[model samples]
Target chain A: MDVNEKYFKNISNRERAIFEGAITMGALFHQFIGTPINIKSAESLEKSIKTAMELQPCINKVEIEINRDILKKIENEYEYISLTGEMLDVKVESNFSDKSAVIRLKYISELKYPLMYVEDVD
Target chain B: MDVNEKYFKNISNRERAIFEGAITMGALFHQFIGTPINIKSAESLEKSIKTAMELQPCINKVEIEINRDILKKIENEYEYISLTGEMLDVKVESNFSDKSAVIRLKYISELKYPLMYVEDVD
Candidate 1:
């Protein structure tokens, strides 16, 4: 619960699902995380993303664009301090573009990281 | 690109490394995704996240919090129309909690979902 990536390395199998969530929306994730996945359904996209999210020790907020007209925020599940007992209706694409523009931001440094690390967030 | 969940299923090898990024922060992606991953380095966590994000056909803005005081927005790499041609300094924790709060919101329905599906926006 220290909030760092090492927690994942302790358990991840480095599979293809890495390309199926918010991580998929980032520039850093695309550069060097895992191999490319290849699923193409709304169900898989949402499920894979959900699978990745549940790993967090804490839940905060989940935001999504419903039809792109409404940006809905699901804060209760996190507020309740528990993962939803049901399935989510979100998903991701398992492909990448050579010319896709994305952003990679350094959000936090594990309060417990042994060494200090700073990213060149351009 | 027609976005959907099944897309990830077509290629996910049921790996870990998933608990290393934004997907690790979602409520739905938590309920059901690939198995768990295991890494323990800030480098791996950041790398895993970046690896997953670059698959989208388009890149958007990436937001990060520098020590939680400075919320930085990196939207250029995404705007320049390409993934950041370098490594990022973000990381994720590969763990979960039974008593943690999280949120899951349905965002899109892929301009091309075969059937009609609407989520309970509560």
Candidate 2:
């Protein structure tokens, strides 16, 4: 059974690229939002997330940046905090057939929301 | 700043519902796939996940079911295993104005992929 032919025939290649990228971006935000982390663990967590998310369909690359400045300012009793959208800046590149898209997830200060959008597509 | 007007106006209400639900489903899968868990921790994890995902835009509710049979069979050295997609059954319900959608994520035995799709929409 061809997964693409069965599951994605209705959408255009461009929409499929956008769809895959958007799904990945959403997955990245939700999956790790509550993980306990400190400055020492941030690098490893970022690497793990990058490696895992790249395994998704059509995803060619995943880049993650966790804000260390926030890690350095931890004042809680645990000396760490659960990861949140504000700490993440992510880019996921996906391709379906000849079409490709770059999806971005960034925390917008004014909206106080993590925005996911198609950054570039062709 | 009108978020719906600025970022999501291009997509129809139905597409927006599908998009939000898909994002949440992806987020749910990636975020929790690596957590250490045993039978005792599964319920708490499900509750936490449901609570957190409901906070996302357009998401009305999240339902998570973690397979406890697998949890009971754990034979690892640590008495727990990192959660995987095979052990999860999830549904994310999202709404965009009058349109609503239910997004589902479940592991497919034949494809060996955790599939996310629009299960229902209006």
User: Which of the numbered candidates is closest to the native, going by highest TM-score?
Assistant: 2
* Candidate 2 residue pairs that clash: A27-B26, A27-B27, A31-B30, A31-B31, A32-B31
- Going through the candidates in order, their DockQ values are 0.06, 0.40
CAPRI class of candidate 2: acceptable
List chain B TM-scores, each candidate. 0.21, 0.95
Best by DockQ: 2
Candidate 2 per-residue lDDT, tens place, B3-120, comes to 7787665566776676677777887787678899999999999999999989888899998999998899998788999999899999999998998988778888898877876667
Badly placed stretches (over 4 Å) of model 2 are A9-15, A30-52, A61-84, A98-100, A120-122, B75-80
User: Looking at candidate 1, what is the lDDT of residue B88?
Assistant: 19
Q: For model 1, how does the per-residue alpha-carbon lDDT over A1-122 read when each residue is reduced to its tens digit?
A: 32123222232222212322334333222222232222223334444444553342221222221121111333444322212212112223231222111121222223221110111111
The lDDT values for all models are 0.25, 0.84
